[model samples]
Target: MESGKRKIRHEFLALRNRMSVDLVAVCSAGIFAGIKKLSAYEKAKTVMFYLSCGSEVVTDFMINSAFGSGKTVIVPAIKNSGDEKMYAAKISRLEDAYLFVYGIRQPEINSGNIVEKNNIDLVFVPGLAFDIKGYRTGYGKGYYDRWLKGVPFEKTVGLAYDFQLTNQLPIEKYDLPVGIIVTEKRVVQIKGDRGADRWETL
Candidate 1:
């Protein structure tokens, strides 16, 4: 499963790297629009969003919109500490959220503002690819996987492009499937196993 995941991850990374700036913006806008239409996001007071980097779907618009719309925005941040665990840090300003870049001076994030896991109402997850059933594989860090364990599935959503959706994906013991996945093509809502009535495609 690990080898399969690695291969799929590489393929998706290469695919994303080849995308034009216009394509990324267009698809990301569509997905972001779909998110805003969801009742889950509408009801969420505090939302956790992954700071996008590299060729992954850009989240700047979504994050900035959240900041201005009276919603508490939380981004994943790691303090300069021995522990490598990803914590939910509330960021009021876009500059406070750091990016994975070289030669760029990073802003110091105060660990004192770490929010509890239960405080986040909605989470926007980033992934390289996602299966039709909503299982996703990321950059192999497992940061979101570990942090999102035990989180209600309905509250978590995966952001991806239309081409990133595959028929199947490798899964591991700790891999938790996403409850909803939004792409430029459509929105997929997965409640449980395939037999569940909650399984839906929007």
Candidate 2:
């Protein structure tokens, strides 16, 4: 299973890397627009967003917009310790972030700015590839999986470009699925009791 996942991850990463910068920007804009239309996003007081890097769908627009709209914006920052864990840190401005972990921007570690997992109402998950079932293949660290284990699945959403969607993906027991996936083309609510009811388009 690990080998298969690694193969798929590599293939998808290459595909994503080939995408044009303009296309990523346009798709990310559409995705954020769709997110704003969700009831969960509108009602959430505190939200966690992954800072985009490389070929991933950008989150800069979403982060800035969240701050502008008075929502508490929390971003994932890597712990410098040996355990390779990640924690959510609150940021009032984008300038608070510094590049870390493969050049991905993250908020500086500050005890006063750390947010409790329960306080986060929503989380924007990152991934290299995803299936209609909401299963995603990240960069193999399992950071999101471990971090999300404690959070309710209903509050998690994956953002991806239309091309990132695949027919299916290999699943493992520890794999945490997103409640819904927002692509540039539409919003897919993975069927299950985990959260959400049906899929819809923007």
Candidate 3:
């Protein structure tokens, strides 16, 4: 399952990389607008790191809005030798977030603002593709899955463009399903308790 997931994620990454600049811009704008709409809900008090890709970038847009409205925001800072696990880092300034050439946004290693996962109220997840059923295929590091183990959050939201979404995805026993998925076009509500709806898809 891990190998198959890696192959699919690689294929999707290649396709996303080949998108024309115009299309990329349009998708980014649409996804950003969708995130902004979510920020207006005013229900979340604290949110976990937003996992995103180069095409799925969500700048301080949602973070700033949430912070301004009194919500605590956090971002993931991957740890470990192979970057297979991550810890949440609190971010307040635009400068606090740094871009990595490999298509991830993270805070500096010594940023000194990291926090525990239990402190998070919501988490914005990322995926190569996700289905209406809530299964998500990530980069295969199992970082989010490992980190989310046992920790509780009010909501776990997957952030993606509509194109990155599908009807299903290959899932592993270790893979975690999100409670809600937010795309540029729509929001999908999955069945089951928070992160328990793991469906196997290929």
Backbone-clash count (model 2): 0
lDDT of 1 at 1: 78
Clash numbers, per candidate: 0, 0, 1
Q: For candidate 2, which ten residues in a row score worst on lDDT?
A: 193-202
Error of 2 at 201 (Å): 5.7
Candidates in order: C-alpha RMSD to true structure: 2.7, 2.2, 4.3
Q: What is candidate 2's lDDT per residue for 57-102, written digit by digit as tens? A: 8998899999888999999987763557789999998887888757
**Reference-based lDDT, residue 121, model 1:** 96
Candidate 2 residue pairs that clash? none
Clashes of 1: 0
lDDT of each: 0.81, 0.86, 0.68
Alpha-carbon runs more than 4 Å astray in model 3: 36-41, 51-53, 79-83, 99-103, 109-112, 152-154, 193-202
TM-score of each: 0.90, 0.93, 0.79
lDDT of 1: 0.81
Off by over 4 Å in 2: 194-202
1-202 in candidate 1: lDDT tens per residue?
A: 7898899999998999999999899988998989988999988899988877766788878989997889998887665544457778887777765544331122355756788879999999989998866788988877788888888887889999889988778888888888899887788887566323433676
Tens digits of per-residue lDDT, candidate 3, 1-202, equal 6677878898787777777767766765666566556643456677764735556545456667677878777888865446666778887765666676356777776557878777677778877787766778877767788887775422677776677777667777777777667665665667665343443221
Displacement of the residue 85 alpha carbon in candidate 1, Å? 1.1
